[model samples]
Target: MNLRKEILVTGAAGFVGRETVKQLLAEGWKVRALVRTADTNPLAFHAGLSVQEVGDIAAVADWSSLVSGCDVVVHLAARAHKTGEGPNAARELFRRVNVDATVELAKAAAAARVKRLVFVSSAGVMGDFSARPFTEADPPQPASEYAISKWQAEQALREICRQSNMELVVLRPVLVYGPGNPGNLERLMRLVASGLPLPLASVDNRRSLLNVRHLATIIGRALELAEANGKTVLLADGNDLSTPELVRTFAKGMGIKARLFPIPPLLLLAAARLLGRSHDAERLLGSLQVDVTLKTNLFGALPREETLRGLIETGQAGR
Candidate 1:
């Protein structure tokens, strides 16, 4: 009988998925990468990796055969957030992909007798802004359809796991950033590269962010840590960077100078609100810190210099 521990990873082509699969392979775990398409798979060069093409994660039925025999399933696929979506439409779309699909996958994992299911959830489930660092004790108040869907999915998975006696580990990470990252981070990178004077110097809000590699490390640890079973924990770098600081750091990482000027927080908010961008205002001018001591205390702090180096490398990579 083969003694290797087998693991299944969904969304194997995504940023975090790619890194997680690579790290698992390096650690000698047999990885079954489930991706929507096999063509140009990032895991192609990886040795000893099993690739399964399961197009449209949300629509897939009968995951039992694929999940059978895997020790753990790391689920990372979901419907990405979009701008200017109506409440009803957004809810239904998010439910279709994030909630409905995830519950289906969890049911399959449970049926397969998988020991654990590590789910990648967003910190947005706690809302876009928080005056203080969010903790596990706080009740969820999801602010958007995407976040609401994730929150609902978490609840559903918890019940499913409870009923099936399967371990569920949910990780909520805030604003993951790395090379080739999309969303606001990529937009910020572009803005910084433009050398345009940004009126964010006076904004004194703390934002927590996670590096893709760091998140991957956490996922790996969750798979092995018995203490992590049946827990919902938040993941962050534990280093909070303000908007100005982030801009400066990103600029420095790119070997350029940041052009920034002080702008009143209230004024920024008013302008954003006027432009029908309250969400953008809150993200830019508000704080969304998360208490990540739970993971840091277990793994120790990721050195600031190491993280800065990663930022620089990511910036240089120009993605």
Candidate 2:
């Protein structure tokens, strides 16, 4: 696990992939970014990185050449959205990208004698957040197409590693947020910034979040430590924040008072169902938390507990 060795990063154009690549480059690692097209450049900001155009991982073309000189493979490419497409379409796309492509990549990595394969998995595979505080040991009860695909990918990767004798490390991170976040967190921030009254004050649910910097640091440490081999780690900032508190914190950080109305949870759920936005209700009202003690103890490093403060600071800086 020498920092000077080469590593192949799939989905290098993605949010987490971009940050991870930056960290790896900063550590003096040679990065070979696998992209779909030669023109699909990420925010590398002119950092000196080797780029390879391997179109559509599902096609299963020669990936051995891609990882020929790499010591590690970090798989970050997957279908990550939840809406717009139907469930069947989503499942099929995810299976192709997450499951089939991942297996093929691992096989190629093993063929290339790569030392480690790190898979970025989603915590949603643990199931909906109805229950607070889920751990890595919890039986996977994936409730959505996205979650199911991630779980299947993990299984496929493990089986491939078992047959090929390659080291596998799976990391499940919850709601990774940072300055350029583009998911639900960004949507909420936009709404809060508009000074509109949000009906999330009554939702008393706690959820775990990971800052991108912390996540990148954990990935780097996992690569360096051999003890992380054949292990699954759930990553979080070791702090849980309620929906109201999160919104209020963001609002206050933006120099505005939070305009929140405490609506009944049941009524909100019904409204969400009628509007075909049940995911929104589930996220705001559901209680899903994680314990990062195992990750901290294993790596001898802990994520900062000042998640809200960090978010505020980073978000404002970005603004």
Predicted model with the maximum lDDT: 1
lDDT computed for candidate 2: 0.82
lDDT of 1 by residue, 13-61 (tens): 9988988998788777889899998886777566658899999988898
Q: Once all C-alphas are superposed, what RMSD does model 1 give against the true structure?
A: 1.9
Candidate 1 lDDT score at position 270: 88
Global Cα lDDT for candidate 1: 0.85
Q: Which ten residues in a row have the lowest lDDT in candidate 2?
A: 82-91
| Total backbone collisions for each predicted model | 0, 0
User: What would the per-residue lDDT of candidate 2 be over residues 15-59, giving only the tens digit for each residue?
Assistant: 888899898888878888877787867746535488877778788
Residue pairs with backbone overlap in model 2: none
> What's the distance in Å from true for residue 118, model 2?
0.6
Candidate maximizing TM-score:
1
